[model samples]
Target: MRGLVESAEIVVADGMPLVWASRLARAPLPERVTGADLIWSLSELAASRGWPIYLLGGPPGVAARAAGQLVERHPELVVCGVDAPPYGFDACDGGREKVRRKVVEAGPRLVFVGLGFPRQDRLIAELRRELPDAWFVGCGAAIAFAAGTVRRAPAWMRRSGLEWAFRLVSEPGRLARRYLVHDLPFAAALLTSTLLHRLTTAGPPFQQPPS
Candidate 1:
């Protein structure tokens, strides 16, 4: 686990469930880190620290808007560049490498990758091996929210963990199947399986590595 984390450019705790799990596993986490919050915090920190930043992924123009908004909010922040990749993963050709080279040349201290889910995680893992100096962070849809391209749930809704409800209301057509039909069911199944395993097992439980 330490090897993977040491290999990572910047390891971020993404899912709330993961954060809670870390507590149960007795892992020492610095904080309950969310991608959206992390991006803004990093921007503010970079402003005073003078570390250049690069944003990659999201819908067309989303990255630009995010970079612009961040610069406006933190005038001292140096946003090195921004790039929005194709909608589909397979559609992207040299786009990834292009972004990589641009970031390397810009010599940014932080690079936020918003390709979403496993893709973003995988990319950062790869970059961790390839680019040792530049810190890579995987932020799902963070660029869009930072850009105000997508409206987040109200503070109350977020505190209640009902942010998914707000997203569903805002973009039903796009997220209906994802939240309702797929993820929810899969999450329930996993929870049930965990409970059953706990009931059947007698010894100390196994733990997942940080990676």
Candidate 2:
């Protein structure tokens, strides 16, 4: 997880806790930047600049619906195409070739891969050669969020860093262990380490000169 994030071209605080931790370290970030928000932001940029974009990943019909939603909002946005491969498609060469063909045929300027986590990042890494000049974004579930297939947490919960709780409640069977067991401890450790680093790095205090 750390390696994947470190390798990313642009890494932002996707969760509110990260933003809060930054503040605790006295190095505040501009704001939390989630993958869902990036979809809208990038789409707006594409609309203005006449850049055609491709949507890849998400469940069947999801990428297509997300593309429609974006085009409806931004008339000038050019949606080259969408290709939502089957689950675990990344593990197979046939599936990879299919996605490569889509990108080759579309020739889009930007491609959003919303397959989630390491999977999306892995796919982007593998397909970089297919469209060397195009921008490939590992957007996780941004396409699903944009398509309205998955509901996001309430604004208050999101801002308060309880969005994970909300999502856990929404999908307990699927997310319980991930949120409570894995992510919570990792987040705590990360914040603690950040604070400790800040404290240890503080040098000697400045002394005032007297006449």
Candidate 3:
């Protein structure tokens, strides 16, 4: 995952924790830029430019529903294709090739892939090789969110950096281990390291002049 992130042409801090960590390190990012937001923004750009876009991933009807929502919002937007590949499609060369061929035939200018993490990114890399001129966004669950298939956290929860809590509550069985076991420890370590670095690098407290 780190390798994939490092290799990306552009990377933005997607979580408030990362943004806060950057501030603690005295190198604050402008703001968190999440995939959920990007889906709308990028689609707007595509619409204005008359660039055709493709939607890929999500459940059977989700990609299509997302496309409808996007087109409804941006009436001029051209959704060239929508696809929801079966589970484990990326694991087989034949299935991947079929998807690639379909996208190539559609010839969209932008492709939003919601397959999640390493899988989405890995498939984007492969698709990039086939369509060097096109742009790809590995957008995780953004498609489902756009489709209204999944409820997003409320604005206050997002602002307070508690969106993960909302999601965990919503899908506890699926997200419990990832949030509690892995992400919690990593966020703790990141903040701890940042604080230590700041403290160690700080100058000593000022001394009063001799009377």
Candidate 4:
């Protein structure tokens, strides 16, 4: 995780909990920069600039559907390609290499990768070798959200920082342990520690006059 964070050119707070944690720590980042929002904004910029974009990842057919929708929304946008590799494809024979070749062939200025985590980030790193000028985004579930295969939390729930709860309810089988057992408590502890550290360091230290 540290390697991933260190390697990324930009690391934005994606969820409200992370946004809250930053505020509690007094760093006060501007906003929650969700992948879905980034997709929309980047697509708009691409449309205006006439830059082509590549879509890779999400469930089979999802990224392709998202690409169609993006073109529909931004008529001027250029979607060079879309692909959804099978599960564990990254580990299979020449799977990542094959995708790399496709992306290289497309010669897009931007690549939106929805494969999630280490795989998505790793793929971006590999692709960066050949597509040095291309910008890449690791978009987690955003492609599915764009394709409407999955629904995002409502604005109220998102702003309330209960999007995790909404997602747990929406996909309990998939997200129950992840939110209940892992993320929630972990975020709480992290927020508490950050707040405590901020309080401890808030004021200037007393300076005794020289003897």
Ten contiguous residues minimizing lDDT sum, candidate 1:
19-28
TM-scores of the models, in the given order? 0.77, 0.89, 0.93, 0.92
Provide the overall lDDT of each model, using Cα atoms, as 2-decimal numbers: 0.76, 0.85, 0.91, 0.87
- Any idea what lDDT model 3 has? 0.91
Give candidate 2's error at residue 194 in angstroms: 2.5
Candidate 3: stretches off by over 4 Å: 203-211
- The true-versus-predicted C-alpha distance at residue 205 of model 4, in Å, is 14
2 or 3, greater by TM-score: 3
Candidate 2: which stretches are off by over 4 Å? 1-3, 200-211
On the 0 to 100 scale, the lDDT of residue 32 in model 2 is 91
Tens-digit per-residue lDDT, 1-211, candidate 4: 6797688899998878778877776566778888988998999999999999999988888988999889999999999998898898888759877888999999999999998787899888888889999999998888998888999999998888887888899999988988889888998898888878888886643344568
Best by lDDT: 3
Cα lDDT tens digits for candidate 3, 1-211: 8888887788888788898888887777878888899999999999999999999999999999999999999999999999999999977899999988999999999999999889999888888888889999889889999999989999999988999999999999989998999989999999999889888887653354568
On the 0 to 100 scale, the lDDT of residue 51 in model 2 is 93
TM-score, cand. 2: 0.89
Per-model tally of clashing residue pairs = 0, 0, 0, 0
TM-score of 3: 0.93
| lDDT: worst 10-residue window of model 3 | 202-211
Residue 16 in model 4: shift from native, Å?
1.5
Worst 10 residues of 4 by lDDT: 202-211
Which structure among the candidates has the greatest TM-score? 3
Clashes of 2: 0
Q: Per-residue CA lDDT of candidate 1, range 84-203, in tens?
A: 867664346576676556666776788899987667766677665666777778788889999998998887877655777888999999999988998677656655665676667576
